[model samples]
Target: MSSPPEIGTAAAVQVQEVEHVYGTGADAVTALGPISLDVPRGSFLVIVGASGCGKSTLLRLIAGFEQPTSGAVRTAGERPLPGAGAGVVFQQPRLLPWKSVGGNVELALRYAGVPREERARRVPELLERVGLHNVAHRRIWQLSGGQQQRVAIARALAGDDPLLLLDEPFAALDALTRERLQEDLRLVSERTGRTSVFVTHSVEEAVFLGSRVVVLTKRPGRIALDLDIPLPRTGLEPDELRALPEYGALRAVLSHAVRDAAG
Candidate 1:
């Protein structure tokens, strides 16, 4: 088991007065932020909004892929650095086609600086954690889309990075597969106690996955609504939690917020 993060410690991610613009002058387009947020350790934070609301752009800034036009974003009290601060999962699995399932995760472990012997030992364990057990030898093309995504998730966890950043990771899957993966991811996050930031347009997903959900306004995204979900994260099935009245209420509010923000 992984060690739990200390309670009341500094936030895992902090964004301050952040804004992002594209191009410049006549063609300049303001894409995101002038927003601020603090994500506590071990929290599952979901940012939801309409298409083009800059949800993904905000995520990129947090991941250190892009810098904000104004303001600052810090992870672990320093400016976030690409390939250093967090493990990221994108909408597509993007696994290497030539590598076997285990090879993909092994590569991540190697990049994380795990020794060769340790990487071999850790690969299977990571696959199992993402529920891809016994398929470590399968080629990427042989697996279903959902299964490939599981490998992507396993690879993300290979380093045991303290922060997990996902950008619509389940958006391309069928509804049933998406729901299943959501449940699996929630369990994984609870077990590992990693700080997570998820970006999606689905209000239901935001409420279901987040310990806290923030809705962003339309382009030049800003916080439209910020809510805390107090639903039990353990000892409850996914369907049962989704059926809760509080869950519905939160989803409804987020849905409305997203729609209004888009207009």
Candidate 2:
């Protein structure tokens, strides 16, 4: 793979020799072993591995929802601070049942200390960005599964943070809806120039969305392969990228890595 991006430069996030373990002593389990990686500013990085491979654990560490058992995790030149430099989207929408779609997003802004008056303006704009402005006043229950996930994404972006961490956000959707959202996510990431780290078990999704794809080994996850994706980044449809010969080659390589890790 091309040299990994330099850490703490313009890169939006950094993970250096990071490890995470659960339980203690005889019962200890290392969910993720030491691994180092740097994600270039405004680039999309996808981590793909089987279940129990520490994919979600890594995202959690970067989001500061969990502290590392050892080593360091940093974003923008400092150790990650909870709710500081990152925005996270999980597999489920996680919207408050009682809140309107706009209200859900507005809540995230409020927690980020956005002025009340500004939240009124920002909420609509964010919904529009995610193609859900028409449902801005709708209750969370009114939206389809896909639409709810879009709202979740809007809420995550409401913070306008530099780093975005997504853990299988589209895994539960039907294939068609998942593909559509993947395209939307690619466009949004490109438009906003935000650095993103997405974790998923889908090789196709990883190859399609990432500037670089990092595959990890099974339990006690380790970086098994870091592969650069060479699909053209400009004026190309997501489908077109998938059709490219390079895309298929990369997919095959990642497929093998996944099998090896699982075996």
Candidate 3:
């Protein structure tokens, strides 16, 4: 298997002092601001913070789902374009219940102007990559929460985009299922070599999966701490990696940063 790329190596995405606010005047709420970070090409970058810290809001800006109220956001060295090389997996599966699992993935390709024949071929492959091949013919309702999220991930990977943005995609799963899916996601990202920015509340999950983890402050968020996870990128299972001393220390540091920011 090919090695995952180095963190902060190629600059896949950059956000500079961006700010986002909703509503106007007295009713206004600031979701994120003065936030800046770079996600390197083929790296796994995770953002963690307390609720209302703008983790998801910052992700939306990078995914081009929303524009910043101030400053700048760029993807692949250019201004972010909605759904451009930005594949998103939301907390919910958000799949069309009427479509089969493979059909759901195919729909994403179809929307991206992929030909029908190509969609048929690519959908099953993407599903298999996420370990969802057996469920390709299953309906969305037939799968468990974790399986549904896998299908959602398959749909996101269907476009073969350079960047994948996930917002707490496994936050709803049972503990065991979430752990299993995390391993699977790590494998998928490794195999695909796609740069990913994941938003999560779990410091352990962030440390386990990210090449670098960035902790954000409370509302009107800014980077509080950015840490490099120095575990070997190869030949280590997810469980084994968690048991490493470096992993525990990194998690502790992140936990402190998150708690301090929240306080």
lDDT of 3 by residue, 107-151 (tens): 899888999988878887888888875677888899989999999
**Which numbered prediction scores highest in TM-score against the true structure?**
1
Model 1 CA lDDT for position 124: 90
User: In the order shown, what is each candidate's alpha-carbon RMSD?
Assistant: 5.3, 3.9, 5.8
Query: How high is the CA lDDT of each candidate model?
Result: 0.89, 0.89, 0.87
How many steric overlaps are in each model, in order? 1, 0, 0
Report the alpha-carbon TM-score of model 2 versus the true structure: 0.94
In angstroms, what RMSD does candidate 2 have relative to the true structure? 3.9
Task: Look at candidate 3 and tell me the lDDT of residue 4.
Answer: 20
lDDT string, candidate 1, 179-214, tens digits: 999999999999999999999988888988999999
Clashing pairs in 2: none
Positional deviation of residue 106's Cα in model 3 after best superposition, in angstroms: 1.0
Task: Report the candidate with higher lDDT, 2 versus 3.
Answer: 2
**Candidate order by lDDT, highest to lowest?**
1, 2, 3
- The sequence of per-residue lDDT tens digits that candidate 2 reaches over residues 46-136 is 9999999999999998888888887777788777887888888999999999988888999999998999999999998998888875787
The Cα RMSD of model 3 versus the native structure comes to 5.8
Which candidate would rank higher by TM-score, 1 or 2?
A: 1
